[model samples]
Target chain A: MNRRTFLKDAIVVITGAALPAAALEWLDPRQVLAENPQIRWAFLVDTHKCAGCGFCVKACKAENDIPYEASVTRTWIERYVVTQSGELLADSPQGGRDGFTSGSIDLPGGTRVSEEEIIRGFFVPKLCNHCASPPCVQVCPVGATYATPQGVVLVDRQWCIGCGYCIMGCPYGARFFHPVHKSVDKCTLCTHRLTRGDASACVEACPFGARQVGNLHDPNDPVTRAVVSERIGVLRDSYGSRPRVYYLGLSKEVH
Target chain B: MKEYVWRPMYVVVLIAALSLAVRFFLLPHDFGVHEGGYKYGYYRLGNIAEWESRPALFRSADDCGDCHRQSESLSASPHAFISCQNCHGPAAGHPEDPPTLAIDTGRDLCLRCHADLSYPAGGRDAVPGIDPLGHHPFRSCVGCHDPHHPRQEVQP
Candidate 1:
C-alpha cells in the first residue's frame, strides 16, 4: 500500500484499540451510565456509642486491602474523651481507629497522651459523606467523578488525574492523595460488595454494628426508615453538599 | 524542485516543533503535582520547616520525625489529611534553639478552624471556647480533642 493508504489504516486500528481501553481506564461511561444504582441514603457513626474499638478501621483496611504506606483508607475511626470538667480530649494509641494506639505516623503533635482517662470517652468513625452535590466531581475538570441515581458519589479512578483539589475542597477532610499513584482517593461506599447484594465491607466487618448502610430508596431498609422515623440530619450543613449520609440522634452540639 | 527543497526544511522544523511540544506535555505540569509519593503523611518523624521565605514547603512528615520518631505512625492516622501546621502550627527552622515547634496550651488554636463559625460577627461567640485556665488546665488541644476523628454525636 502507498503511504497515505497505509497511514489511514494504521490510525483507524490504533484509535479503535485505544478508545475502549481509554474509556475503561478513565471510567466506563457507557456501563456506568447504563446501570441502575442500588444505594440511596447512607449510615452514620454515633460518636457517643463508639468505644474506640477500631474494629471498623481494621475491618475497612482488611476488607479493602488498604495499605498503610500509600493506599490511604476510605474510612477510619478516632478516639476522643471529654473530661468531667468539660475538657474535650483526643487520643488514639492505635492509629486513631479503635481504642488502641499502636501504629505511628509522622504527624505534628501526633503522640498519644495517656494521663487522664474518662469512661465517657468514645470512638468516632469518619468517611466520605457522599454528598448530593459531590464537590469532587464539580471541581474535577476531566469529569472523573459522578453521582449515582441512588445518590452515591463515585469516582472513575481510571479517568482521575489524581489531583488533590477534592482533598482540599472536602469540608470533612475525608479525601486523601494516593501516595504512589499520586491520584486522589476516598471511601468508595464499597461498590464492589454492594453490587453483589452485600453490606458494605466496613458494616459487615464491624463487630459493634456501628456502621449501618442500606438503600435510602427502599423504605423498608432500617437506615432509611430510621432516618425518617428519627429525623436525622447530614454533616456540615453549611457545606450544602446535601450529603446522602445521615445521623440518628446526631448531636447539634458537636459541629 | 521547489517542493523538494521546501519539504525537507518543513519536515525538519515540524520534527523540532513536535519534540518541543512533547517536552511541555510529558513533563511536570501535565502530570499534575510534584513527582513521587506525598511525604507529608507517614514514613518518618520529626518537624518539617515551613518558613515563609524558604523552599522547604514540600518537606514531608519525615523532617519532623527526628524529634517525634515516637509518632511515626501518626502518618497512618485517619486525619492524616491535616498538615502539621494546621494542628501544631508551623514547624519553622527545625526544632529551633529553644524549641519553638512545641505545641503550646489551648485546643482553641485548633478550634479557631474546627469550631463552628456561626456568628462571624461575635468571633469568639461562634467558636466553642476552651476554658484552659479555668477548668481542665490542659496543656494542648489534643489533650481532649482527637484531631484524627470528629467527636461522636453527643445526644441531648
Candidate 2:
C-alpha cells in the first residue's frame, strides 16, 4: 500500500475506535432509583430528653470500631449551661462519655462558673447533619465522600487519599481523621446495622429514646411526623446546608 | 487541507485515541455515578458494597432475647428502654466463645444516668438522681435494688 493511503487508513481506524468511548460519556446511563425508593434516612435529637448520660457516645465507638481512647467520636453530647447573667458556658468532658458529674464548668484561662449561678442547663447531642447540600462532599477533591441514595453521607476510606479537605469543609465538625485507617471518617448513620433492620447503636443505646433514626420519605414514620408537626429545628440553618438532623426543643444557646 | 492543519488534527486524534485506550483499561468497572445521578454524588459504585460488608459489632436486644430469659425481665422493667449491650458491652460474640457477657454492675454504670446535676430544664429530673455521697456511700446500687426490676427492692 502507498504511504499516503496507509496513513489515511490508520487515522480512520483510530478515530472509529475513540469515537464510541467518547460518545458514551454523553449517553448518560438511565437514572436508576435506589434499592428502596421510599427510604431517606434522617436523625432526630430531643434536647429535652437527652440526659447527657453519654451512653450513645460509648456505644457509637464500640459499634464503629473507633479507638476506645480516641479523642474523636462519631457522636458526642454537649452540655450548655446558661448562667443567670446570660453567659453561656458549654463543655463536654470526654464528649460526655463519662457523664457530667462536676457542679461547676471550668472555662478557659482559669475561670470557673459555680452551678448555683446557672439559670438553665441542657444537653445537646451532635453528629453529622448529613446535609442535603453537603459541603464535605462538595469539597472532596477525590470524590471520596458522597451521599448515599438513602440520604446517608458516607466516606469511602479506600478511595480517600487522607486529604483533610472534607474535615475542614464540614461545618458541624463531624468529620475526623481515623488514626488506624489513615483517612477522613464520619458518621455513616450505622448503615451496617440499618441494613440488618436494626437501629443505629447510638439510638438503641439511648435509654430515654432521645435519639432516633427514621425514614423522612415515609409519612407514617414517627420521626417524620414529629419533624413535620412538632416545633423542630436544625443546627445552624442560616448556613443553608439543609441538615437532616432535627432537634426538638432546641435552645437558642445551642448553635 | 494545509499540511500544518492536517498535522495538528492527526496529533489531536492520536492523543485522544491513546488516552481513551488507557482509561478503558485503568478505570474500575463499577466506578461512576449511579442511582439518583450526580445529586447523590459521583463515587466508586463498588464502595457501597464495601461499606455494607463491614459487620455490625453491636446487636439488638431481641438478639439476646433469643437465648437469654433475663431479657424478658428486662423488657417488663422500667429499664426496658436500655439495651443489654449498653451496660454489658457489645454482644458481637456472646453465648459462645465468651459463653456469657460481662455485666457492668458497678455503681458508676447506674450513676451515669442517675447522678444529680439538678438540671431540671433538660428533663433529666425524670430519671430520679441522688447525691451519690449522701444517698448510700461506699455501697453498690445493686445492694438494695434489683437492677432487673429497680422499683422493687431486693430483700436482704
Candidate 3:
C-alpha cells in the first residue's frame, strides 16, 4: 500500500479505538449507579450505642490526613445534654479528639446545664451524610464535589477552586476547607476502603458497633434489614436531603 | 434577491465554521479527569475504579485475625462482631513494625460503650454502664476484666 494510504488507515484505526473510551465520559454517572443495584450504600449510626469515646473522630482524622484542630474536622462527636427543665445544650469539645470528660458546656443558645442539673445526655457523631440530593454538590459551580455511582460524596481536589461554596452549602456542617490543600473537604464514607470490602475508617474504629456502613440494596445486608424493620431516622429529614446516613436513637436535642 | 440571500448566508456559514474551529482549538484534551485540569470537559468525571487504587489505611477485623492467633478469643465473646482494628488502631503495617500497633485498652475506651446515658435509653442494658468516678474510683475496666470477653474474667 502507498505510504499516504497506510498513514490514513492507521489514523482511522486509532480514532476508532479512542472514540468509544472518550464517549464513556459523557455517559450519565447517575444512570450508571441506577443500573447497578448493589451500589446503593448507606450509613447507620446508633447514637444509643455511641459512648462518646472520640475514637471514630480520631480514626477519621488519621485515615484522611486531616488536621487535628478544633475548627478542621472531618468527623466530630457532639454531646447533647438535657437539663431537668428540658433545656438542650450541644457541644463538641476539640472535636472530641481528647475524648469527653464530665463537664458543663456553655451553649450559644444561652442555656447553661450544670453537671448537677443534667437529666439526660447522649453522644451523636456527625459526618458527611452523603445525601442523595446533596446541596454541596448542587452548589458547587465547578462541579468539583460530586457523588459517586455508589452514592459516596467525594471532592475532586484537582477540580476544586477553593471557592468554599460546597463548604457553605453543606447544612450538616460536614464540609470544611482543608488547610493544606485549600480545597473543600469532607468525609468520603471511606470510598477507598469500601471498594476494598473494608468498612469506613469511623466504622472500623468504633469498638462498639455504633456505626455501621452497608449496601442498602442488598436485602440480606444488616444495614438494609435494620433500615426496613427498625425506626431509623435521618438528620434533618424535613430539609429533604434524603441523606443515606441513617441514625437510630437520635434524640430531639440533636440538630 | 439571489445576491442578497447568498451574501448573508455566506457570512453566517463563515461565522459558524470559524466558531467551531475556535471551540475545537480552545477546548482541552483528555477532559482533565486525571490530569488535574479545571474542567471535567464533556462531563467526563473519570472512572470509579480509580478509587480502588487508593491506599486503605484501616484494616478489617478479619485482616487482623489472619495473623494474630490470639484474636480467636474475641470471636467467641460478645465483642465478636467488633473489629480488632477498632481498639488497636489501624494496623496497616503490623508484624513489620510490631511496636507501631499500640492497643488502647484505656478506661475511656471502655466507657465509650459502657457510659450511662438517659436518652436513647432502650436496649442499652446489654452493655453495662458505670459512673467512671463514683463506681470504680477512676480505675480502668481492663485492670479487673478482659476486653475481648468482658463477661469472662481474666483466668489467672
Winning candidate number (lDDT): 2
Best-fitting candidate, scored by TM-score: 2
For each candidate, the DockQ is 0.02, 0.45, 0.20
lDDT by residue for model 3 over A1-255, one digit each (tens)?
A: 999999999999998888867676767866875786556789999987876778888889888888777468988988877777977777887787766655556667776656677766777888899898877777778656777657777887776788888788888989888898778888888888887788888888876778999998778899999999999888988877789889998776677
RMSD of each: 18.1, 8.1, 9.8
TM-score on B-chain, cand. 3:
0.64
Give the local distance difference test score of model 3: 0.76
lDDT by residue (A6-105, candidate 1, tens digit) is: 9999999998887865566755755674484444657765443443344455556544545644436677655444544765655433444332322112
Task: Please report, in order, the local distance difference test score of every candidate based on alpha carbons.
Answer: 0.53, 0.85, 0.76
User: By lDDT, is 1 or 2 better?
Assistant: 2
> Which docking category, incorrect, acceptable, medium or high, applies to candidate 1?
incorrect
TM-score of 3: 0.74
Count of clashing residue pairs in every prediction:
36, 0, 1
Poorest stretch of ten by lDDT in candidate 1 chain B: B43-52
lDDT of 2 by residue, A131-217 (tens): 988988888887678988888899988889987998898889999999999999889999888888899999999988899999998
Native-to-model Cα distance after best TM-score fit, residue B30 in candidate 3, in Å: 5.5
Among all windows of 10 consecutive residues in model 2 chain A, the one with the lowest summed lDDT is A27-36
Q: Candidate 3 chain A, which ten residues in sequence have the lowest lDDT sum?
A: A98-107
Task: Kindly report which residue stretches of model 3 are placed more than 4 angstroms away from their true locations once superposed.
Answer: A1-37, A108-112, B1-44, B47-50, B71-82, B105-156
